[model samples]
Target: MTQTLDITDRTRLRRSHERGHFDRETINAILDAQPMCSVGYVIDMKPYVTPTLQWREGNHVYWHGSSASRALRNSRDAEVCLTVSILDGFVMARSGMHHSVNSRSVMLFGRAFKVEDPAEKHAKLARFVNGLFPGRYEGLREEHAQDLKATTLLGMEIAEGSAKIRTGPPKDEEADYELPIWAGVIPVTTTVGTPEPDPRNLPGVEMPEHIRKFRL
Candidate 1:
């Protein structure tokens, strides 16, 4: 069963109500599928949107950057909107008005906070690397104290958000459907390619299971 989420005032869908999904499962699926997101916030009433990679742990989403990053610095303790999106295909319609792209997207509102504790931040950092490749973090070089100190991690609770999705063929007006036009979905997909080994890798190092089977 698809569970529904209680829509807060900020998450309420205004236009395409039917396409709005507040369910946690649906929203998380979209987030997990995409590794990057854009965070929108304000600095002295000036708006800014930044592109950064994000990861999900349980119900919270986190992102990290250099300690000196202005975007990350201003984002801490600030009300922000985070969004993730995937382009599935292009929908060609008989008319330009109905032409659109099939996509899945999520918008979240929250006040982001910096992960202050070193131990907590370190654990989250490990999770960040492990989330993409299962055991790669343990096999890589150890993080130094200075390295940890130079990076800052920020997290936001997934308490309020909404997912809007569009799929399938384009919807055209009844009259426009009979026109001599070709309309269909030109599918788009993201796939992992063959692994390219580094020339400096140690002799006879075997590719791990995680890397061999990664998708998206």
Candidate 2:
């Protein structure tokens, strides 16, 4: 049996309940597929949202940024919202009101904390790089002390979250479906192109397999 989350008032699905999911597997799948996430945090009574790259490990989600960022600094001990999404297709409907999009998204609520451990933070950073490009971390040199110190890593538990997904064609009014209008879905996806090496090169170095076949 799939484990389900307790639906609190804030996390409950008020409408289109069928499209809502609280299962761990569903939530994890969406998070794992997307590397970019928007994090919302409040600083000194002012609201702010910042976009950054993120990675997941177990029930925790981690993101990093320059240590100098005010939002990242304030988020160290504050409750925040993190969201990730992917657009699968566009749903065309006979009526404009019914036009929609097919997408999968996850929303998480938790208090983020700065990762203070040097060794742990280093490993987390490595995971972020290797997650996108397999075996590439081994090719890079060790992180400099100053560089590592300049980076700030934050982590939050996926204790409270929800996933909202929509797929297939648009749902139009019953009478509108019979009208003379073409309706279907236009599929969308993220693709990788050929890798371009840096202009300054020491010798002939071929592109790595991970770079040649990168996909999300």
Candidate 3:
């Protein structure tokens, strides 16, 4: 894959162009750091966006949903936009207009394709689970054929996208910096909390290392 993504009208940043990045390294890093994403697609000339979990492997990104989902059905072989964002901090400036967010976000545009082969779909699902919680899939019950049939996996190559990131203190006007009001960043982070075990878990079934060590 090329080191940088091709810049097209759709991928160009019209505002705050300084924050735009086209390198694959920056794009992949942001995608891997966040699993939750929103997918935008059109149906019958109406637009819709669905929130879902995403996983990346090599130069491709994948997301899954119910086979009966209207979004997944219409997204197949259709142009779609996938976006992932991570909020790092809230920028507080002297003026309300200067207040902003410190964040990293990526927007990708492509034609989504369905994973038609059952075996390939199954493997991809396992990879998705194992990617988040290593070795956890092996301890769980095997997936039923019906379960796999009810799930739909869609993927797109990471060929047309750009990442926008903002960090550090807010940018305020030179005159505003002298104002008496304090200005700084309030850091934000996503943290994993303690895991709660199922009430019905069998006796002597201990929490696996993968679960204990899992991080987002």
Candidate 4:
């Protein structure tokens, strides 16, 4: 496989191009770090973007939703844009125009395809669940056929994409740097909190080790 993705007009960076990266390592890192993503597609010539959880396996990324969903329906075999972003901090600059965010983001352009085979879909779904929660999926009840039927899984190869990242302190003009106004970064992070178990859990049932130690 190529070490970097080819930059086409669609994936080319128009501004602040230094922040853009076409290397697979950087792109895959950002994708693995951020599971939340937005998929943009067009329906009836009107654009639509849907927020969903994504998982990457090798050179492809996958997402799922209700089988009857319009977003999933329209996305199948259609060209789409999938993006993932992680805000690292708030950069407070002396001037409003200079204020910005420290973040890592990736934009991918590709044709989305539905996973039509039942066995493959089930395995992929299990991988998704297990990827997030280790062995949790193996302990869960078997999935019903109807449940599988109600779900839709879509995937796209990571063939065309770029990772754009911004980090560190703010960049202010020479004059603005001398101003008395306070300016600095407010770090932001996503943390997993204490797990809240259902009150109706079977008597004497304890929390799973994975639940207590989960991190994202």
Candidate 5:
């Protein structure tokens, strides 16, 4: 069955209908492609949103923050929205109101819970580190007991969600297409830069191939 969820709005968001995606494959791709997400929740009757790095394991998404983080503390046991988005290009149209962006975005609505098991929490932390940089955990020093105590990890299962995407050229009005106006997509991309060694580091410690050859 193709699961469907209500989009918050429809009119102002022109492509609300066409832009929304319900497939698991599409949703997972958007989630795995990016490492950052904005978690939204209410704290003390006020809305709060915080940006942080996240990773997925099976159906659950994992995020970590300091134990003292206000956003993390308030999110436990609450309904939350986690969103990951990437802007791929700019849609230049003949009219200002028609201008839009080409993007891949996923919004997940679910309940957040604090991970309580020490062993499981440590394992999840390892996975989170590995997701950011493959083979990094092996090269780095092992986590100390205090490090675990200072961090709080939370997991949320994506109960209901949607992926919205917009790509290709602008959809200007038929009459406006005849107007002498430049119309096209300005493609955007993210690229990795060469690794620079720290000033205090030992001489001739060559950059690892993984760092030199990485691409986002």
Candidate 6:
């Protein structure tokens, strides 16, 4: 497939491209690493973007919502863009304009469609649940028919996509070199906190090791 974003002439949109990554491996890594994405599409001539949790299986990404969701219903068979990003740090510089963020982001452009097969939908739902909490699927109660009917699943093939990453310190002006100021990167990270147990649970129930040791 053709690259999502052409990077040959970097100067035209240098900032966006200089930080843009197009390797398939990098793109997939960014996608798999994040569970949420902002989906962009046009609705009745007005553009809208909504953040929702998503999962990736091979070259396809999937997200589900209520069957009544306007965005989900409207996006069927239409072109869409999905973006996932994680801000890793802040680049503090002497100049305000030079200040930037260190981040890893991926943008996917493709056509989306609703999954109609009940068997496929169930499988996809299982994958989504497992992606969030590994091994939880086998323990949880099976989804009911009514529950499946109320939910709508949409899948988008990764026909074209790119991952962009920016890291390290700021790029200050030549003249700013002599300025006396603190310039460096302030690192940021995401961590899982202590899991809260259900108040109604059995008094002696302990937290599962999977939940305690989870990291992504």
Index of the highest-TM-score prediction: 3
Question: RMSD, model 3, all Cα superposed?
Answer: 4.6
Candidate 2 achieves a global lDDT of 0.83
lDDT of 1 by residue, 86-160 (tens): 888898999999888888888888899999999999899899888898888898888899888999899998777
Model 6 ranges with Cα > 4 A deviation: 1-22
Candidate 6 residue pairs in clash (backbone atoms < 3 Å): none
Residue pair clashes in candidate 3: none
Q: RMSD to the native, candidate 2?
A: 4.2
Model 6 earns a TM-score of 0.87
Model 3 C-alpha lDDT per residue in residues 1-216, reported as the tens digit of each score:
112232435626333233445367788999999999999999989989999999999989999999999989999999999999899989999999989888888888889999989999988998999999997778789999999999999999887777777888878989999889999999999999999999999999998988899899
lDDT of 4 by residue, 1-216 (tens): 112232435626333233445366788998999899999999989999999999999989999999999999999999999999899889899999989888888888899999989999999999999888899889999999988999999999987777777887888999898899999999899999999999999999899988998888
CA displacement after TM-score superposition, residue 195 of candidate 3 (Å): 0.2
lDDT score, candidate 2, position 18: 41
Q: TM-score of predicted model 3?
A: 0.91
* Candidate 1 pairs with clashing backbones: none
lDDT for every model?
Answer: 0.85, 0.83, 0.86, 0.87, 0.81, 0.81
Per-residue lDDT over 6-66 for candidate 2, one digit per residue giving the tens place of the 0 to 100 score: 2435536333234445366787998999998999999778889999988998989999999
Candidate 3's C-alpha runs over 4 A off are 1-22
Per-residue error (Å), model 1, residue 85: 0.6
lDDT of 5 by residue, 1-216 (tens): 112233555242334434545345677888899988999999778889999988999878989999999899989989888999999889899998879888888888889999988889989988887776777677778888888888999889855677777887888888899999999989898777777788997788777766776666
Better of 1 and 5 by lDDT: 1
**All candidates' TM-scores?**
0.89, 0.90, 0.91, 0.90, 0.88, 0.87
Q: How much lDDT does candidate 5 score?
A: 0.81
